[model samples]
Target: MTIKEQYVAAKQAYANWGIDVDAALETLKKVPISIHCWQGDDIGGFEVNKSELSGGIDITGNYPGKATTPEELRMDLEKALSLIPGKHRVNLHAIYAETNGEAVERDQLEPKHFENWLNWAKENGLGLDFNPTLFSHEKAADGLTLSHPNEEIREFWINHCIASRKIGEYFGRELGNPCLTNIWIPDGYKDIPSDRLTPRKRLKESLDRIFTAEVDETCNWDAVESKVFGIGSESYVVGSHEFYLGYALKNNKICLVDTGHYHPTETVSNKISSMLLYSDKLALHVSRPVRWDSDHVVILDDELREIALEIVRNDALNQVIIGLDFFDASINRVAAWTIGTRNMIKALLYALLVPNDHLKELQEKGDFTERLALMEEFKTYPFGAIWDYYCEKMNVPVKERWLTLVKEYEHDVLAKR
Candidate 1:
């Protein structure tokens, strides 16, 4: 049977379960996932003094034809977006700013530094997100940033974050969407630190100073991310989950969660409901971690599906901001973006296709047996047919057809770079 014919069959199957396939597709289309810009250049931004990556963040492998300039990065992103279905946003690091061949300090950044990105995003009909580059800098050499003991270094990082909020606000004002500015610092010690509270206190003070100049929430929203441990911070991290959760609750800011930022066994999916109870909203940096926070390319794994299911089950699509955060240089950069993003969409689509109401009724009635059975049964539903239909509607390649486009672009465009 043809794709549409299969979709019709799947639609009938779902109808028997009281699930509206059409509504699920519509809801999935409306959800916008933010694609990280670092994937194109392997986290090497367009900075004049691009220092070696430090502070617990590192990208492995060296695939050829990585984007070297702001224009090239955007060009690659445009190609990746073409293969992925649905409208999406682009997450940018402050280091990606185009300073027009001039040296620009992180603290001295303004909206004008990203005028090119703003124009590009406007033309593409994409929303923008921002992050302060708190790592891989001269000041961050000690693996400390906002929580640094040096007062001068802490002030410098604080100024950078404050400036990032203004830039985020500018993007939101221009694009008519609220830009999510997230702060994640790799401030911890490789070995044990004697006084952890002192650094955390300094970090809190710095954050307070940064948020003193409040911007309109309509234009830009603030989020603080926490990490259990990082490469050089295995001993202790100041911005643990407990720290940011308290800070977010007290300051009324959004709590950003990175899936790989937690322990190996702990899942961010389980924390959704708990975070929703406290914070007004949540932000997510979705990435796969094999053993540690490796930032591997995301796939449609169990954890990915669970996270998507939680978001949909809680009906928090609007309140939660979802974005991709991974950098794998082992494969084609554009293809990596397309694959990870398509998989993310697939997970959400799978969650949307489930007979959530029916399953809920079973759980409420204490019919655990049927709830378990139905959950397993829904896993084999004809999700691919509906996914193909959605991709067709979105004017993107279905299945593996996107790989062909990426290969062609690599030979014709990226190869030259």
Candidate 2:
């Protein structure tokens, strides 16, 4: 069938199934796009070249060296950003100020590296997805202990945040842009029972510091919207994230949702919906699924592809930032990164084309089972259709369309077989 015919067939099939096809496709088109650094190590020579899938590797380890030489990082980032397709960029890494042979510091990233990075991003016609402070596994394993949460850890966290603020100044004044910062708290309870209020209090105090800087100094968006990081595999107790969200909203800070951080038992769609319901001010840290690890893979699963698209389409939250949280070693292929990113974009377009009315109806009447059923049914309809639609929308040539179709068909067959 022709591409248009295929879209029509898919639409008609959905209609036959009592779902609104047009509304589903329409919702898929409105999401924003971004670039992330999942493959930095590959480019940096830490990982073997053959294992590198993308041009770079993820700075996933506790290497204090990553942030020490800001100039080296800037050159590498410039090279990577030159490869991206758009004008906006976002990156997440655990960087420190220590030199090449220095011992890794827990929270020792020099704020200047971030400033240089932001400056580079601005110069390169890209925006920033600046995840200023990330956590290490050691910290995750051994939760940060504070004798007086209000006095000690709070101060340390604030100092780190101030460093981030100093970087924000460059974005606001020098770059004429804003940096997107996400605070993913790795400080959860260890084996022992801890006072939830203390950690929460510490988080709030730290956030207050960041926001105070944001409000007082620079005009970057990151300052005003304190991105609250919550509930990693190790950090949060059962209700810690929910409480954090409540607290952040109460204090005018935004909840930054990382796709892979939640427990396997939690429904991501529900969590996203809940966050959106509270306030439109939000940020997203996107990645793939994992049982224990926060595998920063480009989202490719059919189900998750749809959910990610929906998050962008349902832009109730005015500020939506797309993040590729994948961090692999250097031996991986750059082609894989391109394909994964393209697939994500394709899925988003498909979601946008989906009829919003169908989602609304399903949401209105769907119980748990019905909702799952609806999501499953409505998922692929738009993704496939939109993929085809976008090629045409972009004015792809007929020959290119045929080649793409052949590849997609081959992929689908292999996936099924």
Candidate 3:
């Protein structure tokens, strides 16, 4: 049967469970996932310094044809977006700012530095999300930023974050969508630190100073991200989950949950409901972690499905900002972006297709047998059929067909680089 015929059969199957396949597709299309730009350039931004990645973050492989210029990066991103279905936003690091061949310090950055990006986003009908580049700089060489002991260094990073917020606000004001500005620092020690409270205290103070200047909430929102541990911070991390959760709650800011930023066994899916209880909204940096914080390309795994289910089941789809965060330079950069994003969307689609209310009612009524059986039955549902229908409707390649476009681009465009 044709794709549409298969979708009709799947829709009829879901209708037996009182689930509307059309409504699920519409809801999935409306949710926007912010695609990270760093995946295309291996986290190497357009800055003139071009220093190696530092501050506990590392990209493992060295695939050829990584975008080296602002124009090239945007072109690659445009290609990746074409293969992925759904409306999406682009997440930008402060280091990606285009300065027109001038040396611009991070603290001295302005919205003008990203005017090119703003124009590009506007043209593409995409919203922009911003991040302060707190790592891979001279000041962050010690693997400490925003919580650095040196007053001068801390002040410098603080100013940079403040400037980043303004730039984010500018993007939101221009694009008519609120920009989420997230702060993630790699401040920790390789070995045990005598005093952990001091760094956190300093971090709090610095964040307070950076937030002192009020920007319109309609334009920009602030978020803090926590890390379990990093490459050089195995012993102790300053911005632990506990620290940022308290800070975000006290300050009424959004807390970002990165899937790869937790312990091997810990999952961010469980934390979504708890975070939604207090905060009006939250952000997510979805990536796959094999055993640790490896930032591998995301796939449609069990944890990913659970994360999507929690967001949908709790009725927090509108309240949570979904974003991709992974840099795998070992494979085709464009293909990596396309694969990870398509998987993210697929997870959400699968969650939307589930009869969440049916399972919830079964559990609440203490019908463990039915609930277990129904859950297992859903595993065999024609989810892929509905996914193909959605992709076809969105005018994107279905299944592995997107790989054809990626291969063509690799030969024609990436090979020239």
Worst 10 residues of 3 by lDDT: 48-57
State model 1's lDDT.
Answer: 0.93
What would the per-residue lDDT of candidate 1 be over residues 259-296, giving only the tens digit for each residue?
A: 99999999999999998987769999999998999999
Tens digit of lDDT per residue, candidate 3, span 68-142?
999999999999999999879999999998988899999999999999999999899999999999999989998
Residue-level lDDT of model 2, residues 225-251, one tens digit each, is 221223332334422456657756787
Candidate 2: misplaced stretches above 4 Å? 1-31, 42-86, 92-116, 134-142, 145-154, 214-218, 222-239, 312-317, 330-336, 358-417
- Where does the lowest 10-residue lDDT sum fall in candidate 2? 47-56
Where does candidate 1 clash, by residue pair? none
TM-scores of the candidates are 0.99, 0.66, 0.99
What are the RMSDs of all candidates, in order?
A: 0.8, 8.5, 0.7
